[model samples]
Target: MVLTADSYRVLRGWVNGLGYSLDARLIPYLELAGFGSATLTQTFDLQYDLISALVERWRPETHTFHLPCGECTITLEDVALHFGLPIDGDVITGVSVIAEPAVLCYSLLGASPDDTDSTFSKLKFTWLKANFQHLSVNATEEESVCPARVYIMHIIRGVLMPNLNNNKVHLQYLPLLADLHNVRSYSWGSAVLAMLYHELCRTTKPDAVDLGGCLVLLQLWALYRIPFLASVSHQPYVFLLVNRWSIYPGIGRLYTVLIYRLMIEQHTEEGFIWMSYRRPEIAAIIPSSSYVDSQLWCTNAPIISFNIVEWYHGDRVLQQFGYIQYIPDLPMPVGDVHGINKRGKHGQHWRVTHQIFVAVWENRMA
Candidate 1:
């Protein structure tokens, strides 16, 4: 797609609608790094730089990732050992394993942006194609049910939380456009962004908020097809970010509240679909009604429909924390809503059940 200045604004607004912002410090770093930067600049090369950073930092592992690849049998411990990286009490060092390749991809430019058939795009296409095929196969055959959910969640997670943690075995790389600008500082940011993005955009059974933190890593083969603007460039476009410590979009304890609010809205809705697989107890506490659905679909939530004015209007609670205003309340359905069937291993199932009490109060009527 021709991502123009206007389109960029729309994308930014979409993110802003969800209460996120581009880190001010990041743009300057882009300039300093020799990569040109602009608020609405349209250069696929620049775009590719961001995507490459993400693909580069990619460390393939099965468990330890919020978005685990069910198809892969390798555990996080296995991945660390395979990479010959030190695992200190579940933590991994040497980010260079991911950073170097990202930096290299950040610099490339010169190919025609219209070449949708370029090598990079081809890779992305192939990855997506394979994923689509897998999904189709799993849907057709119940035998692949477990593996299908695992792989599908992995792709969803890659889109959701694409960052690595400080720990060796922990999944990192929350995929955010801004995080992709600077690999080192924003890896976690990116990972969180991935989860947040998918949570906001993709909805099925549960309300968007409960699924907010969910994510999975798509295997490297699954990612090779997607193309970014930077693949055409031959130079690393300098990127920048200030105060790496600050989570620019302001995701923190407060952000967690956003997720809490969403669960409340979904649970109370009529015939609302709740996911009981991973955590049935928590799902049960959502306060079911006949209006809710027993099945969930990957659909967007209605809470996001709130007008900025209606969302921010005269609401003192949100006004107190100015940043809170940035996050708009997702609109709830006017009528029937579907709930999801929960699935996962016994251990995972109980883990979610144990957390029901925490979410139970969330549905209390004022």
Candidate 2:
């Protein structure tokens, strides 16, 4: 079974197309949760082929792309700078199997699905839109918080850490959003990266077709790092660098997936910009806020999100972080660990199930 370049292209339909109507009432909550930096000024489209090209280059064994230029993978710094999400903070883990999905929704989100299935932990995008998009004009502070939670839920379910269920959002994350004030404390960016890493690893199998993670992130990370793949951006620079590809057209959009695959294969080390973010012109636009805890961008730790655990190997790609590039040591052998997930092992707490990696994530001092 030969895995051709095209075999890796997993076709997907986006949930964000349901529309982004972030109510003005929710900005305060969004700002509180450190998500204010994520700008969704426009509803966007994704080229699955572009993402497929990058996946073809991804080496799940090392969790880095084996490009002609050298090993390069999306770093915590890229997640922090590009999306402005918190990278260094609490590990995002919780009960995957919510016993009472409807009750959980009603308690935190102020509403639940009309048709309640006892085993269902996922809510439809339309339900969230119908219940939360239009907050009451005279909504109380408490009432406002509910919609804010829903908005973040929509973002996560739609793009950030989406599953294969395009229309339905898993209700497991709703528990974490219970305290709107503390939402910022969780390392959402890390979890997002973890999910992407898992997706990259899964797609490497010849039979895998469906992908379930933030595709936008992988595509943007590639465009920003590879100077050749990035397009000329005339738009004024935005902090969360998603502006480059989200709202405006980029060079990758103009090329076919085959072209992108060929371009990546032909790429040489000189064409890769190891530290493009540190450029004077680029640095000038990024506000000081994004640099907080700049130390953790190179954390040599595991990026954990619930049952999913994937290694974040910043040491391997030191050059991308402005450090002198050296051939680093081998990737930690994660033998059967990468295959761990919340399948038949239902109703178990992630903290206990993934205790080993969670310990590494908890003691994230670096």
Highest TM-score: give the candidate number: 2
lDDT of 1 at 104: 24
Model 1 residue 66 lDDT? 17
- Model 2: per-residue lDDT, tens digit, 249-320? 432232345556776777646678788788899999888888887788777788888888898888898878
Question: TM-scores across all candidates?
Answer: 0.19, 0.87
Instruction: Note the Cα lDDT for every prediction shown.
Output: 0.23, 0.76
What TM-score quantifies how close candidate 2 is to the native fold? Answer: 0.87
Write model 1 residue lDDT over 1-366, tens digit each, in one string: 232222111111011110122233334433322121212212111122222222222222211111121111112222121121111111101211222323322323111222332222111223323332332322323323222222222332333222222011111111111222342221122223223332323322122122322222222211221212123222333111212312644322332223223332332233221221124553354333311221111111111100100011112122211223344333332221112112232123221332332132122221
Q: Residue 241 CA error for candidate 1 (Å)?
A: 17
RMSD for all candidates, in order, please. Answer: 24.1, 6.3
Predicted model with the maximum lDDT: 2
Q: Candidate 2 at 39: error in angstroms?
A: 4.8
lDDT of model 1, residue 303: 14
